[model samples]
Target: MPTSRFEVLGAGAFPMLVHGALILLLTGSIIGSLRKIPADAYGRFAADVVAWGKAKRLVFVVFAGLGLYVAVMPVIGYTSSTFLFLITLLVTLAPKTRTALVVALVLALVFSFGLNWLFAEVFNVFLPRGN
Candidate 1:
């Protein structure tokens, strides 16, 4: 028995309709852009990508930090994991002045501990608490 106005494989009609519309819209957008962007723009973009690939310092540093954060999140819990992540980012990216460091530290603490408390008590959405 058919459940929706448009159904062939038992999917809901509304979802199917939305998906079909999105496909058409995205296809039209891609086709339009394909004709609009110049060939030299693509060549310049590719050269920039290649240059970034060759200079892998910033990209690799971020990837390594993410890997470490994921690996230790279970051991340290959500609060510590988030705080450490923010601190690491600040240390690497933020200015080295004393005032900037102090402000970043304060913000990191508030984000980590404040968010944990808000989730657990206010929203009753408990986050992971590692041992």
Candidate 2:
């Protein structure tokens, strides 16, 4: 049976709709830009892409870690998952020094727990808690 319009727009529909629209806009922009690029520029674009891939490996790692964080949040609880994600990301990105490590740790703790506390205490919104 086909669902009604009301059912389609209920609950998580708004975010999904926004995401879809943003994706469409991004695709259109990319296609438009690529169409305007001259054939002679293809080699340069390819070289640029390769250089970016080599230099920005950490960017891919951070995105993968974020995906993992979202997947594990429901199982490990929001605070623990967020703390792990932030701390790991900070340590990965920060300089390899004792002071930097300490600063990253403090920032991770503050962001994870502070946000959690703010949401739960101030906003009266609760995140998922694992058993």
Candidate 3:
């Protein structure tokens, strides 16, 4: 069953729904533009998508990691969940280099700490600490 935006977002869903509708409108316009493109262009575009997909197995890994991270995050604590999420996403999305891994680690640490601090200090929201 599809969740209602109201159920998920509380009162904020009204604005979010407006944004979502605008995005759909924009997407429709893009599709219309694409349809006006020459048939040869469309064929080339399709080929490009196929070639890109074949070259980047990383796409699969990143999407799978995102799905898993969403499912697992609420069950675990934020720190552990975000760490796993960042590492997996980075490994899948970027080149596997020592510098890349280090950058990802730093980014994950900053994101986790800043987000946690913002919620706790500014918003007075307390996230679960599974430990």
Candidate 4:
């Protein structure tokens, strides 16, 4: 019945608006809570924040890798991408090998199957199976 691939102001906009509003609400809530915390907590909390900021290099790298994974996932397939993402995260974070491997395997399975299921079944969006 539809002619064009997309119709102006269709179903997609609602999700986008909802997500945006949720983000705004969450940001407000976090800011409000942080402000309400006692001033006595500031010394330790500020030190932790500074330490975290100083330790952000690896964090940035991981985020960059996530961007790369998203870019490549369409070509490599969800399972492969998920495995790479999980393994990369585990290795870079220097987790204990036994726990890292277990966590990586579990994460890969969850991401590949669970996310795929969510997209295909819950959202009715078909994510590409590059393989």
Output the number of the TM-score-best candidate.
2
Q: What does the lDDT come to for candidate 1?
A: 0.87
Clashing residue pairs in candidate 4 (N, C-alpha, C atoms within 3 angstroms): none
- Ranked by TM-score from best down, the candidates are 2, 1, 3, 4
By the lDDT metric, which is better: model 2 or model 4?
A: 2
Candidate 1 versus the native: TM-score? Answer: 0.60
Model 2 — which ten-residue stretch has the worst lDDT? 1-10
Indicate whether candidate 2 or candidate 3 has the larger lDDT.
Answer: 2
Better lDDT candidate (1, 2): 2
Off by over 4 Å in 2: 1-51
**C-alpha lDDT of all candidate models, in order:** 0.87, 0.90, 0.80, 0.81
Over 83-128, each residue of candidate 3 has an lDDT whose tens digit, in order, gives 7788667766768899998898888887777687889899999876
Q: For candidate 2, lDDT tens digit of each residue in 57-121?
A: 99899999999999999999988999999999999999999999999999988888888999999
In the order shown, the candidates' Cα RMSDs to the true structure are 5.0, 6.7, 9.0, 10.2
Give candidate 1's root-mean-square deviation (CA, Å): 5.0
Q: What's the TM for model 3?
A: 0.52
Candidate 1's residue-wise lDDT over 1-131, tens digit each? 36765655565667888999999999999999999989888769978888888798767778888899888888999899989998988778778999999988998999899999999999999888888
Segments of candidate 3 deviating more than 4 angstroms = 1-56
